[model samples]
Target: MSLPLPLIFDYEEIAGKFYPVIPIELKVNEKRFLTRAYVDSGATFSIFNAEIADYLGLDYRKGDKIYPAGIGGHICAYIKDIFISIHNIEICCEVLFSDEFTVKFNLLGRAGIFDRFRVCFDDSEKKLYLYEKAYSDFR
Candidate 1:
């Protein structure tokens, strides 16, 4: 029902913050590699680092183009269907990738990943709960 959220601590900043990160496996051309991604409920689209696009054999610029802006500023990215594996469950998800995307962190947003799973984040317990939902459940 509840799973521990992978977190990292930083002491360089005056006030340290807890980052909810998870190890997700990316599958491309049947090749698999493990990577870390931040779970964000507020993000409109999930985005990954450019290196992953290369590893996945994606050109990163030829797909559908979209300019997304936020507090970090504007970034140009291409939308592509990416295969992601988490907790032994695999899903084909739409993700944005760009050379300018920060290589330091990958984001798992609310669109593709949230469509299939019910997510609950509890700061008190520092846990993320995920439940699979059937097609009929949403209707």
Candidate 2:
């Protein structure tokens, strides 16, 4: 079975806060899990909460330490490889693992996943397309 392409929603800023939440289904260790992740173009890598990794039975010890920061400050995180799929497209890449105190869901960043796909934001349709290649070749 194939998964549908990602649905992109227009990010709106409330007060001075920017909310860029995107719905995503993550496949790890042959297990499927669904959650909403914040799409952050500014981030260099994708990150997932430790609780999610534990629930999915992902091996935490295989990960390496990486430092990431939020509004509060910088924190040490673990980075590991996982299989990510969207719209029948699957790719193996490294993702960051953070303790529950940091975040709840995954954070889709610029490297790994996003770098592999040609992404287009259709403001008119309010959808995000992850093209196998470029937008012109997308079906």
Candidate 2 residue lDDT tens string, 1-139: 4533544456544466556666667777678887777776777888887888888888775788767877778877888887776545666778888774366546788766666665666555545555455434332
lDDT for 92 (candidate 2): 72
Which stretches of model 1 miss by more than 4 angstroms? 1-16
* Residue lDDT tens for model 1, 12-62: 211366566777898877777798787888888889888888887777687
| Each prediction's number of clashing residue pairs | 0, 0
Per-prediction TM-score:
0.82, 0.71
C-alpha positional error of residue 72 in candidate 1 after TM-score superposition, expressed in Å = 2.2
lDDT of 1 at 133: 68
Q: RMSD (Cα, Å) of candidate 1?
A: 4.7
- The top-ranked prediction according to lDDT is 1
Q: Give the worst 10-residue stretch by lDDT in candidate 2.
A: 130-139
